[model samples]
Target chain A: MTPPDRRRRALLLAGLSVAGLPLAAWALKPVRERPRLIIVGGGFGGAACARQLRYLMPAADITLVEPRAQFFTGPSTNAALASVCAEGDIVRGPAALEALGIRWIREAATALDPVARRLRLASGTVLDADRVVLSPGVAMRWDRIAGLDATTSERMPHAWLGDAQVSRLRERIESLRDGATIAISAPANPYRCPPGPYERASLLAWRLSARRLKRCKILLLDAKDDFTKRALFQVGWDTLYPGMVEWVPHAKGGEVLEVDARRNTLRLQNGSRLRVDLASVVPPQRAADIAVAGDLVDESGWCPVNPASFESTRHAGIHVIGDACIAQPMPKSAFSANSQAKLVALAIAAQFAGGPAPVPRLVNTCYSLLAPDYGISVGGLYGVVSDRLSTLNDGMSPLGAARELRAREAAYAHEWYEQITRDTFG
Target chain B: MHRLAVLALACLLLATPTTRAQDSLSLSCAVCHGARNAPSTVPSFYGMSTAQIESALRDFRSGAREGTAMPRLAKAMSDDEIRALAYEFGAPVR
Candidate 1:
């Protein structure tokens, strides 16, 4: 071979090796090279945030912590009890998370050490991360109700979260024969699932109307002067099972003072004793004793958060969202919690990127199943105001329209649920 | 050549204003609500009452109104922006 030919071959080989260098480095690079983000509760909020995180910032690592293997969203959960919708319709798997490379811890978080930025899990494994999100939904304040606790919930079934308690209430509805008087006792504001009790009543009515339409009446006792979707609930009641549901607002001594779940009776603030075949009880709610015990909540039993980022006011690097956080104008719904999760995720991303948090756009929609084909919904947008969340005016459709409108809304309501479930765990 | 193309793309991105996050969103209000014949879907904001804006903001903020992404975007705007945007959006063009 000539000298020039050998020299050209050597230069070609050097160029080829230089080209292969980047490919070798890329092949050897680790998958989890980016920053790690740990999100608690893979329900609407956590899951949505995780999903949106992929769109906004795909390079970050997100780990979602949830005790449940599958998520059952509340958006369409009310329809399950009413027989208007099926439970499977609301249940969604981890396909959405898997797409975004979101790792999962299949257990609840027992404790959080914000200072160390470590999340202690129930399985004794520890998750140490750059950011920790706690969206552990809301728990009942049993102390507010003199005789009710977690055990009592087993019998009465808040059924707000649509789990074991939800099925328990449905079973009770099935067992009760004609002319059975069922009482739905509701807790005060900031409770998880604000429209849950009414939705349960609607479903129970759906069951009753199937067999004995006019024979049974479900009395809904409330602690608020008026309630979420009151007009919608009223319209549905009027159309589906007229005179079958009685709604007592808070002003009329509707605030629950005591409950005897064993006997299926309610003791109101007044000296009134009401006996019923089945009583579904929703006790007052505060932050989970976990956050409160850990000094996460303020005096109001809720963790105050900067609505924009959902970051803890008392602690940095820790974000609180879902029903446990104080969102004044935003109702403590699963949708609201899910939206807050995305905002928090962005805020965490901004922090990781060493930049100020980009203001977020949050959305929420609540659908109620009034009858088999009747549904009503209210959806809105949310914003951060003075370190808290407030709703934009006229963002939601007024609930409880005319009979025809209610039924039409119900059809749309099912679609809304399916869309939200996809947004969460789809 | 690839590196130069990448550099060119980056420069283009740098050249394009990243549109101010919030306050600047109002700049487009003129495009929609300004002098041109407003589309049917576009509601007239010119000469709109403040009470009307407050009412509208309340609806957008809370999800009482439906069918648009306005609530989420409107909620993010400060009350002052809502007021200012309302006034500016409502102002009659000279």
Candidate 2:
């Protein structure tokens, strides 16, 4: 056994013996065995939770169930679209979890019985745990958008979920002609990364401008009238891209009602239709399928979690974090997921120890790149007030900040990306 | 080195249950300043006197010091909480 594991075992044995528990309690009771923690999903939320749990509760048996061999972070994928960084830069092997003594089960979770504390894997293996953490970031709602399905994704890549789709979208942008038009459809609220579509549009405009494709323009169709950091993005687009971008809000023929992938056309809710050379459709999203299958989600398509402990209100002993849970005032970003993961880790430890979980004051900072060096950010500190997630104090980058401040924010964004990845994956 | 790393990591990871006034404020301060995993790069709250940390927080809460997030976080913290955090994080790492 590793040194840490040995120390944990010693501590457990000592505690059991010092309590003077009966033989039945120590030997006969199955629940009294080392508390097993099954973490579903290995994205930022799952991976970071696993590592933190292993660190804080060494005696707990932690197993992470993730289907993917590597995690591709969507936080900085816009930089990849602009060719500022290679697609590989955002992808990382999740094998580092083993260093923290976390057992990784490379399989998809098919079923979860919260009442029985049982989880079933795709390979037909059933594992029981004392507590389970559901961190399956998000499941793309393909059914919400008509004429859009997995097959349609080949032509009109959403590129919002994984690395492969992101590369496909980049390829579509690269092959565009000088006069070719590209359109991006932004989804409704409560999706992963609120400002992501705008960031992608800004970066694509930068690339098209750099290539001197003056006639090629980007058409951003939004499902919402206003977006997170809309003013900041508008200022950046006007200053940097000039007349190369057009944004249409939902009230003005922006909400996409249907997509004719065969003709590369979009039918908006406002009775408008347009054909484009390339289309990036970000559909409405919901919690992962496993969360839904376990009956953990509500009619809102998101899981309601107690902001203090992130415990699913629908079920007990199942804590949901990251994008899967509704942590309002906390955007579904990598930083928020990491912050929430830490909170979940501690709450679980306190739960098993029969101690009260302290209220967490979480923070989230989201950065968007206007150029390679020019960036803007919006951030806030979140805490629980009267059972709802409340923003203590929040602000965004001044729209009129100097170029140097934007550059510094851009650098800080990169630094944050590096730090969060290390904290999560390593 | 390992012990220091563990302490830093612990500061970041697990939130100590707040039994006293200072403990609660220290946990809040750890949110942005540093923690077991996402340690702060701004400045070390460790190895400082309670007086020093308290002065900084008071200045931030009152806008005596120019800042952004700190001022708001400090504003939410009571004077007693700030004094408690000062003493909590002030002790030198063993």
Candidate 3:
């Protein structure tokens, strides 16, 4: 037999004792030989899956492959950019997962072979597993925008991924002179954190106001005509910072055509040019390169999956979650990713237990901070309907809620960050 | 011998109903309510009676109790799901 066939035979033998062997002998084998599971990426989805799987299957061999030692969460990076929290506050390391007996490989996953259930690392090492769960988040489509490749991205940071780009944009905002014009380019639908750009605009305006910089203008150039929680966000903006922020929607020439990074100028779709002191352009996005290289993504540039199991429709024995997968009616937020990861973990655990997949009931709640003391939230419960994930019930925070209610939500938002980060990282 | 082994494994899963219930819907509660003894603003129902838990959820669903997100979340759950969740999470801490 060939080498791979031999390996498969050996694994099968290891998984089940010989047909005539005594049941006692089969039961006595070390539990460590039970199964091998590998998880890619260490963000909310990946880490939460690792933690939940470790809880459900104590003896399964679990390994997490993440190149970065520290992970900066995208959920609260807006607060850090607005100076409400320090940049260090949003950072978490894998030491907690390591302490829980999870093996952490600090190397990039260069490629994946879905049929073989094997992953190749940057150091030319191949890791094979019984199952692989990928949560490699979104990657910016730099080619879609002119004059906004990797080099120009440094000068005009998108700050979408909660990396050094956040600090780059923060520095620009801090150094702005009074009456300076700051332009923020919002991307079209199906991006990470739908309410993120609006929240960023609100917090940055608060920051500028705190600095007592009078007449500073924030131009919110949105590519889409409508946004999530539009009326609520507009009401908050009007109440908090009157005449300081202007939102230009797609119909009003809000679509960004190109950027002259050197001159700090943006060319809108209506053939109008606006020069600004600082520009934060959030570009369109797609699944990360690893998914594309593995042939996991379809024509839509996002991975399609069986919503019940989150197992890739393109490949068996591999599941894709988080921003990389198309889970409609569930916005790509940290809460949604965490929810999807838990369901995936339980589905895998059910498989190991020799039971049918559990009926899936997913939930998500996203909290956006308008100011440090003001917050709004949108929440939903989802289930599979007609083979698609559909929202069962959903609602957003009430419009014109009392000040005390908004403040309570603000406190709950902070507590949510703390609890979610702890639950995921630990 | 393989058939006998499979039979024994099947017998071992006698409590599969409760395990299945615990594995699905209740797992989502940890994102906010969190595990027992963890610091969270959301209330924990670890030691509460299952009846109490069920009543609260029903109240939220019926609009008898006002909440920021719970009412909407509770509306999605059926009576059976509510009982499963309450029984799973409301079991007294051993």
Candidate 4:
């Protein structure tokens, strides 16, 4: 054990003694046994919760179950697609979490028994925890989009999740001829990253402009009539990429019914065909398979949790955060996940101390880049009202702001990404 | 045992007398401002006095100061909450 661990254990023992617990009774229990906290999924929510739990309860046996050795953040994947930054810039390794004594389990959790507080790994090893945090993120619902399954996704990459799919889309964008048509089909509401499709379109426009591909047409086919940051993105598009991009809302037959990857065509709900050189279709999503298998999800296909502690209402000891849970009024963004993770950490700490979880004040801020140097942002504060999360105060970047202010916000956007990733992963 | 007792006493002395609400509220700030050692374009509140934090927040809340996100965030905080945040984060770093 490290010296800090020794010190913390001593403090804990001393506190227990002060509470009039007999030394003999303390000795009866295993001296080395500490609180076991198992966090499944090592994305923003899981990783951030692990780091915070380490700070709050230094001696807890915390194991993070993640299959990947390295994590790539979704925030900047659009920039990577636009070639604004290299793919390596967004990659983070688990060394920092490891240095804090967090056990990194490089394996997938095959099953979860919330009632028993046990998890079964793909390797057939069962681990027990006092409390479990499931931040499994989202799993794409391939069945929602016809002809768009795992195999077809190879041809029409979503590139929504931050992975090699981003590279795939980037390659397709790079290989496009001057007059090639690109179709990007966005999903309906309650999806991860509300402003992501718009940001993706903006960044793609920026890239095409840089490559001097003036005649290339970019079609933004949306399932929803409106999107987050619509005004800001439309203004940015009009000013930056006029006549280069077209956005078709659902009312205007923008909802895609089927995608024929072989023909490079999307059949719209209105029975119109859109033949394009490349197609990026983002399908509807639900909680990951593990959460569904654990019976944590409600009828909405997302887990419902007590707003104060994020404890699953369906199951007692398991807390769900991130995209896997239904946290309305809070978009499923990285910032929201990070905020939820911290609150869950505090809730768990309070539980360990035999106190009720404190009422949490959650905050989220998301910045979208229209260009490398132009940005817009939306931020909100949330608190529980009548057993539901409600927005307290929120605002977005002022429309028609001066160019200089937008530039400043753009710089701050990069800074926010850097600090948030460092805080969570470290 | 004597050394352990001394350590315990020191730990108590070092612990700040802040409520759970304040601790939870201050955590949101770290998402942007970050820990003391982490470099950021956003200003760190490490060495700021309680008065300074209070003043800045009030100014931002009242539109006397200009910021991208802080103004909106400050508007959400009550005066009591602001004072609590100031007290929580205003401590000098050693």
DockQ (C-alpha based) per candidate is: 0.06, 0.15, 0.62, 0.62
TM-score per model over all chains: 0.76, 0.85, 0.91, 0.90
Q: Model 3, which residues run further than 4 Å from truth? A: A1-33, B1-21, B91-94
Candidate 3 backbone clash number: 0
Give the RMSD in angstroms, all C-alphas superposed, for model 4: 5.7
The candidate that wins on DockQ is 4
Clashes of each: 29, 4, 0, 0
Tens digits of lDDT, candidate 3, A1-426: 136755665666656665554444333232334678999988998999888888887888899998988856899888998899998999986668988889999998989999988899999999998889999999999887788888898888888886789888888888998899989889988899999999999998889999987699999998999999899889999988998889999999998889999999999988899999999999998999889988899998899999999999999889999999999989998888888888898888777665567788888899999899999999999999999999999999999799888888988899888888877886
Provide the TM-score, chain A, model 1. 0.86
Show where candidate 1 strays beyond 4 Å: A1-33, A54-59, A93-96, A386-388, A395-404, B1-94
For each candidate, report what fraction of the true interface contacts it reproduces.
0.04, 0.06, 0.63, 0.65
True contacts kept of 3: 0.63
Q: What does TM-score give for chain A of every model?
A: 0.86, 0.92, 0.93, 0.92
Summing lDDT over every window of 10 consecutive residues in candidate 3 chain A, give the lowest-scoring window. Answer: A23-32
Error of 3 at B80 (Å): 1.5
User: Per-residue lDDT tens digits of candidate 4, residues A128-232?
Assistant: 888899999888988887899988988999887776787899899889889989998899877888898889889999999999998999999988999988899
Best by TM-score: 3
The alpha-carbon lDDT assigned to residue A16 of candidate 3 equals 62
RMSD of each: 11.8, 7.3, 4.3, 5.7
Ordered list by DockQ, greatest first: 4, 3, 2, 1
